[model samples]
Structures are given as structure tokens and as C-alpha cells.
Target: MNIIDNFDTLHRAATRKAMQRLIPLMCAIYFMSFLDRTNVALAKAQLAIDVGISAAAYGLGSGIFFIGYALLEVPSNLAAHRIGPRRWIARIAVTWGILSTAMMLVQGEWSFYVLRVLLGIAEAGLFPALMYMVTLWFAPNDKPVVVGWIYIAPALALMLGSPLGGALMQMNGLGGLHGWQWMFMIEGIPSVLVGILLFFKMPERPRDARWLSAEEAQALESRAAADAQGHPELTSSDWMAALKRPTTVLMGLIYFLNQVAFVGLYFFAPSMIQQMHVKSPLLVGVLAASVGLGFLLGVLILPRIHRRYGNDCAFLGMLTVGLIAGACAFIATSSPAARMVLLAVTAFFAGGVLPSYWAIAMKRLHGIQAAAGLAFINTIGLIGGFVGPYLFGLAETVTGRSDSGFYIILVASLLGLLLVPLFAKAIRRETEASSPLGNGSAAGMQS
Candidate 1:
């Protein structure tokens, strides 16, 4: 395969300009992704009070979505690989949109549980599907930056979802629907519209993008393929082979460790803050939004940090910083403002290191292999998504303190810092081969 001539020298402006068209769409999709999933967090206090769902039951419902999400991941990824991303992604968005809207209809614990499961089923492989699409557009060295962009979607979601959710909750008795109902109705519409947009506007591959000139498309495709040739495991389409890789298992572990802290804290952030004696929905929204803002700020500065610090140093450093900041929550237990600042600091590190972690993972997988490997990794990691909230709720129930659950954040950060280097060491040769830092191409990364 002919590598794109001067891929090492591709102009940063050229690459950025090309991606500018596609990433905004992805960011929008991710905005919907997190919004639909976590909007429930915002609605939790009112929904529980209205529907008589217990704390444990609510946690179960929140986490149950990931069960369906995990179970169907490989299958969904295989389907997406076979059918193409536009159709599969659009299909996911529309179905999940319907389910998300139907959340307003939840009348009891069982209804809430059922809808959560269904929502999970609808969103099963969305992440892997999008990851597969990214491999088609970007080179290995570029995947981290791309990963950062996708996450900015969630960061933006928090910024928007918190305020929107708070405001909508004030609309109680509108059309005989609660404010939470209105929130669901309004938030769910954007997803369906995005689905329609995906079907009509999203291209299956670079070659199919009408807006990209032939030279641009070829450059993207050639560079992507060139990176894959050095490591077939990085882009192979074989799902079974992907599942069997040791690295696949390790990457999943890393994600699981990370999520054990992040997702659980996130799922209950608003109500937990309320437990600090703060009652205003608008204030809760603002505080929650700050954590997301921290995430966005971290991602915005990440590429520069990675360039300056090297990926390994940058990765471990963020975890250490987050660990210190997160543990401070226990110290600031009485001060809501201090707690928010600490959580925001924790969010910064969690968000900052994600791209580097994904960059390492993507270096070893691409295409169908990437699809299946990512699905498997995500499937396992999402166990944390399920476990985090439920476990937090259980812990909170047992300990009689909402803040008790947040201790997991520090534990997770410590584990990640300790385990990541070992995982990287185990795959030393592969990382060296694919890592721009190892090959002295770090300066060429953005280009």
C-alpha cells in the first residue's frame, strides 16, 4: 500500500480543515449521547419524589442501561461494520431518541427499569461504531486528538444539559406533564433530528464525502492505511481475534478502572450536591456544569501538554493531580463550593488523560478489529458504568452519606496511575513502533 506522500508533513491547517466538517457532527452526536444518558441524573430528585422510586432502585435503573449496552456491543459493532456507520448510527440515534422520550412515561420502578434497559439496547455499540468511522478518516497518530474531540461532546453536553435540565424541571404542570417530562421531550427531539441528519448527511467513508476533494480523501485514506500496515492488529476486521488479544483485555481494564470513579460520581452529582444543603436546581446545574467546563478546558489544552510532556508522562501526571484534588472532597466535606472546585479539578485530569489512553489503545487496533476490539473493551469497561452508579448508591445507602461514594474517584485514579505503566511496559515494542514520541515524529503530530 502506498503511504500518503508526506503524511509526516501534512499541513496542520489541511488536516484541521478537513476534520472541521466531520467532527462537529460527531460532537453533536456525543452531546446527545451523554445528555440522554445523564439527563436522568438531573431529573433524579424530582422523578424519585414523583414516582416513589427508592435510591437503590434509581441506581439500578441508571446502571441497567449499560447491561443492554454491554451485551449487544460486539453484535452491534459487527452490524455496523457490515452495514456501514451512517445507517447503523442513525438507526441507533432514532431508536434511543424514542426510548429517551418515553422516559417521561415512566410510572413506577419497573417501568423505569424497562426503559433503561431498552435505552441501553438502543445505544449498545454507538461508541465503537463511531470509533470505526474515525479510523477511516484519521491516522494512528491523530486518533488521540480525535478521541479528545468526541469526548468534548460529553463535556459540552454537561455544560448544556445541566442548565437545560434545571430549567425544564421548573416547567412542572405544563401540558399535564412534569418538568422532567418536558425535559425529556425537549432533549429527545434533537437526537431524532440528528439521526435524520446522519442518514442523509453522513458519508460511509472519506471516498464518499462529496465535500472533500479527491486529493484530501486520498490523503486521509492512504495515511490511515499506512498506519495500519505496520500493525494489522490495529485495523484488522476480525472480531474474534480482537476479543482474544491480551492488550484488548488490558485496555478494557483501564477503562473499567477509570469509569469506576467518573461515571458513578457523574450519575449522582446533582442530588449529591443537593445533599450538601443546597436546594436550588439552577445552582446545582451551574456547579455540575463547572465540572464539565473543567473537562473541556483540559481537553482543549491536552494536545499542547502531550507535545510538551510526552504521552506517558502526561498521562500519569494527570492521574496524580486528579487523585490529590479528588481526595480533597473529603476535606472540604462541609463546603459545597470547595467540593465543586475539587470535583472540577478531578474532572480536569479525568478528561485530560483520556485522549492519551485512547491514543495508546487505538495504536494497536483499527477497522473491523478496531470495531470489535473497541466494542469488547467498551463492553467490559461499561461494566464500570453499570457498577459505578449502583455501587455508589449501595455504598451511600450503607454509609448514610452521599459523599461516601465519591471516595472511589481517588481509588480509581491511584489504580490507573499504578497499572497503566505496567500495561504499557507489557506492550513496549508495539507502543514504541506506533508512538510518535518513540519515533521522533512528535513534532509532526498535529500536521
Candidate 2:
């Protein structure tokens, strides 16, 4: 039978079984990562003075996490690949858990900075490693949805964290630990427990996956092989080669710009809500959760939009509109309700880019190269992630206006609109050159 016919025979349960096992762990880890990172922001509204740090100094400490994360991303991902993902991921989990517990010792800015850096180092490889695992297990057609599903954890984290994190911190009476300390302790422990559970569950690859019957494995593999046009295996040297590609570099730059906007918005969303004179932490969390809900809806809708309009148009179209909406939201600070609506719209549009971009990355990379390529892309992107929060904090410090720095984000988002068209043309040219008709006439397409 041909590939499509073979795929038609797949036991849906077998295909879904891995996902059922995988999605929870993926969500838990990413949720914990975001919770750990952003919990500081929520805590800051009340805890900064109690913790003996100025607001500006806390911002500096927060920004320090991404710096360590940015520096370690490539090497950590490489290590995850070399030492094997199962053990490596478990190690990252356990180490970060301890770091989370260590947050209880944050008596001042110095200790917070140290623990943030440790958290960064622990989380450095996680997303890229997950992306690499996706390439091994899911077929291309199924991949986008799965990626979107896994990537939704960030959104879910925001949704859950907005209210839940506040409540956890509000539980300061237990043994006299502060809310901030509880935030770390409670969120951090789950990762270690999940890590231990994961060892018994996660398979290295579909071929080795014991959960699937022989027929189920063959069915999944056949679809993947057909979609991927034969699997490309990668050695250590291949990882190096993938990173050297011009397209990879360009994608990295795009990812960098994207994260600047993403991380900045997330790190400050609760604070922004607070600045609008919403004094209740619970209320601020609720508004933030609204944005997360919008994000969740967008991910569900984006794939269908891409199928109809093609990737470039969909990306550019949404981002262009999102930038305008976000700018207007920031500028029109007169009405808090209006600002919240616009922010929700911006979050919705911004969330779509992730899964589509990951799919694009996977399309261009295969095998072990996917891990390193994603790591390199993220490493460059994380420089922006590092810079984003600091930029906002610095601008706020200098101007005494939080809204002023959003202009910079608006400009960055518009520039990202331009990059999408360039990416589209590059993708099309890549397709044509690799086709039988074009030959060496399009030699520049050789990535």
C-alpha cells in the first residue's frame, strides 16, 4: 500500500496514546517554567519592600534570569542531545526544582539574582529539546497541531497563574513563609515529581516506542516517512552544519524580535493592570487570564487560516494588525477597559506565530539538526528575551512612565511584519530551486 493508504489503517488510539502521555508532561514543565519566571512579577507588587529590594532592583534581578538562559541555551541543548533527552530532561527538572526551593532564601537582590540565574540555566534546553522530540515522533501533517498544543502551555500558564499564583502567594500563613517563597516551592515540586513519572512513560522515538503495537508503529512511521520525504539522520557534525545555514540565521533574528515583544508583554502584564489603578492582585490576575484565553482561541484558529492563506500572508497579516492594536492600546491609557480589550487582541495575534513558526522550522530541519537548529534560533532569540524586560524597566525608570517603552515594542512588531515577506520569498525560492525544473539557476537557495 502507498503511504496514504497505510496511514488510513492507523489505530487512532495508538497515535493518540503517546500524545495523551506526552501532552501533560509537556504542559506541566512549560507551565512550571512560566510560573517560576513570572511568579516574581506577581510577588513584586507586594513583596519587593518586604524582601528588601527596590522595584528597579527587582527588575534587574528578573532580567538576569534570561541572561543566564541565553548564555546556556546552545550548550545545554547540545548536552541534551549528547547525553540523551530522557536523563537530560529529568536532570534539568530536578535541578530547577532545587533552584525553585532555593528562592525561599532570597533575603535581598543578590540572592534573588543567584536563584534566577540558576533557574535560567535549568530551563535553557527545555523548549528546543521538546521541539527535537516532536520531530522524532509526530508526522508533518500532525506536527503543527501537536506543536500548537504543546506550545499552548505558555498561554495556559498565564491563565492558571493569573489567579492561582496569587492565591498561592496569599497563603503566607503556613509556617510564616512569604507568598513569593510559596510561589516557588509549590510550583517547583511538581516538575520533579513529573520528571520521575516521565521516565516510566516517554519513549525515545516512535520506532522504539513500546506503547505502540508493531502495526501501529509501521503506520505512524509510514506517514512520517512520506511526509518527510525519507528521514534524514544527523550526526554531531550535522548539528554544526545546520546552525551555519543562512536561513537558520535569518529565522534566529526573527525569533529574537518576536520574543522581545512576547516576554516583555508577559513580564509586565500584571504590573500594567496594577498601574491602571486596579489595586487587587486577584483582579489583575483575572485580566491577565483573559489575555491567555484569547491566546488559546487564536491557536485553535490559526492552523485553518494558514491552510487557506499560506504561512507568510497569515503571519504578516496578523502581526501587522496586532502591532497597530497593541500601540493603540498603550497610547489610549485613558480607558482601562478599552486597553484590556486591545491587549487581548494583541495577545491573540501574537500567540498564532509560535506554532506556525515551529512548523516552519521543522520543515527546514530534520533529525538531530532540529534540536541544535532550534537551540541556536532560541539562543539568539533569548538575547531579546533578556533585553525585553530590562528595556521596559529602564524606560520606566528614566521616563517615570511605563507606557513610553511600549512604543519601542510597537516599532519592533512592525519591523517583524517586514521580515515575514522576506521569509516567504525565501521559502518559495527554496521550494522552486529544490524542484526538478529549476536546477542550478537558483543556486543561492542551497542552505
Candidate 3:
């Protein structure tokens, strides 16, 4: 065979490997991404004396991670867009791993603050880059499930990582190192290894895959072309225009409010369990794991629900149910059943949101336009993401009760409930005005 034929054969093989490679890679990295992000939660609860950080200081430390994360969020993603995900993602993973392991050295509030900030900086690119990669590789029809799968990472981390975190933290005999320090060291090391592995495995883009045949590459390129038809070429102006759109703004607001509830619960859930008279850190981990179970179930079920009710009804109904259940949980903190019910409801809704959000965005946007749009939405959303945990911690410090944070979440959930309707109205109008594409196809993605 000629060189051209050899290239074609290789490209085809690479294309075939994409889905299998992509899903597992995303799952593993994000699992560590989450574990690294919340190792501090475990640390705060159990390593308090070891770390020498106060509760209020802990909240500040938690919130500062997001500020650090927020500072670089857009820029890191933009860099990923410019440099491609493989190298940038590897850099992020390795950097976070080093910083996370260094948490062992933190002896005071200042060191903890510095380390958390570094962790945030390390994590900045991950989610936006993942979303960007998905847009590059998957068709709009296949996006919901793929995105849903990626979104399951955090949940799985909670389910699996939580118990593991508790166990590692109990490793105080492994030198003079504290349990909390070990938590960071153990959680962060695997990410560094994964980063090295990513260098070898993850492709820069679909076209860069050397294992795909010419026919396969052409097919993938064609699918991308068809999806690009209705969308304007991605430009700075286009990005600005998308942001200026009332609809985009509405979606951002809704996501922001939603994160306030979701992120707050995640950061504080362990502490909440600890305060509920559950003396065992392992037991607290188990309860938090339940939320993770809810998340997995939510992602698994959203496709069927979407097929049944359509995106608009599915989303609005989920938010409404979420708001009600969230409120009940906050109000009935004394009742374990009520609190668990609320946490499950919240996780389910949170889990389902990413898939629907991506599905809607994919149907509406394509190419770099989708990447920029996801970045923008996520950037705005992280504002709340950053705020939620800090506010929760701060509120708990001030009030001496962590339940106040949940009540705050209850209010934010209501805001999310209110915003979803407006988003639906605007989206419906946009769809009606434009040529609405129905459910996209797997073939449609590879067009």
C-alpha cells in the first residue's frame, strides 16, 4: 500500500477507538478532579486539629479555591482551545497532583489557602475542555448521553472517592503526616499518573487521530460540516453576540443559581452529616455516597425522561421537583429521612442538568461556537460555584449551624425554578423562528 493508504488505515482505527477511549478517560480524570477538589472537605472534618484551620477559615479556604479557579477559568479553557486539550489537560492534571500532594506541608490557614488556590488553578480547564472535546467528537444526537456520562464523574467520585478519602485520612501511622495531608497526597498522585498517561493516549482532535481510515475521517468531517451549516462562524464578535443574547444570559443566570444549590450541598454535605450526630467519618462518607448514587441514577434515567417529555418539560419539571424537595430538606433537618430525600432529589436534578444543557446547546450551536458558548455559560456558572461553598462555610461559622447554608440553597433553588421558565420561553421562540432540528443522530454527528 502507498503512504496514503497506510494513513487511511491508521485513521480509521483511531476513529473507531475514539468513543471507547474518550469515555473512560473523561471518567477517570474527572473522578480525580472531583476527589482533589473536595479532599479539603474530608480534611476539614477530620483533620481539623492536624491542619490547624478553623471552621470560618475553612470556609474561606474552600471559597478561595473557586476564586482561584474562577480567575483562570476562561483563560485556561481558551488556552485549551488554542493549544488543544491533550497537552493542556495533562498539564492541569500534573500540576494539580503536585499541588494536592503538597497539602501535606500545610501547617496553618495561610498555607491551606495557598494550596487550595493552587488546586483551583489546576482544575480550571477541565470541565470546559471536556465539553469542548465532546463537541469536537460527538454528534448532537449522541451528545446527551456522552455528556451525561462525563457528568457522572463527580458523582462516582463521591460514591467511590469518599469512602477511600476517609480510609486514607485514617492513615496517620504512615509517618508524622496527618490524615488530611495523606488525603491530598493519595488523591492527587493518581491524577499525575493519569496526566502522563493522557500524553500518550488522548488525541488533540478527531483529525489528529492517526488510527482512522480516510473514509472515516471524511465521514467525521462531513458530519461536523452539516452541523456547522446553521451556525455562524465562531468569532470574537459571535461570542459577544451569543453572550448579548437575552436567552444566553437567561441560561447563565439559571445555571448560576442552580450551582449555588448544587455546589453548596457538595462542599458541605459531609460536614452536614458529621453534625447530624453521626460520629463516624466513614458513616458521613456513606451518606454523601448516597447523593452520588442519586446522581448516577439521574444521569442513567434522563434519556428516557427526555424521550418521554421533551427537553423543556423534562428540565422544568426536574427543577420544580428539585426546588420543592430541597426546601423540604432544609426545613426538616431534624428528620434524617427528610434530609436524605432532599439530598437525593438535589443530586438527581443536578446530574440530569448537564446532559440536557449540552443537548440543548449542541442542537443550537456547533464547532468553536459551541466551545465558546459552553465556556461562557460555565464561567458565569462558576461565579455561583465559587460563592456557594464559601457562603455555606461562612454562614455556618457565623450562625454556628450549617443548616443555614441549605436554607440559602433553598432560596437559590427557587431562583433556578423561576429562571428555567423564562429560558424555555426564549428557547421556544428561537426554535420556532429558526428551522428546528429534531433529535440528532449518531450518523448525524459523524456527518
Stretches > 4 Å off in candidate 2: 1-4, 11-14, 222-231, 313-317, 439-447
TM-score of every model? Answer: 0.90, 0.91, 0.87
On lDDT, the stronger of 1 and 3 is 1
Regions more than 4 Å wrong, model 3:
1-17, 225-229, 232-237, 428-447
Tens-digit per-residue lDDT, 106-202, candidate 2: 8877887888888888888878888877776677766778888886888888888888877776777688887777877888788777677666667
Question: lDDT by residue for model 3 over 279-375, one digit each (tens)?
Answer: 7766777777877887777777875466344455345557556656766665776787677767777777766565776666666555555566677
Clashing pairs in 2: none
Clashes of each: 6, 0, 15
Error of 1 at 306 (Å): 2.4
Query: Ten residues in a row with the worst lDDT in model 2?
Result: 438-447
| Tens digits of lDDT, candidate 1, 363-446 | 667777878888898898788889888987787778877677777777776776676655655465444554766753432222
List per-prediction Cα lDDT, in the order shown.
Answer: 0.77, 0.72, 0.72
Higher-lDDT candidate of 1 and 2: 1
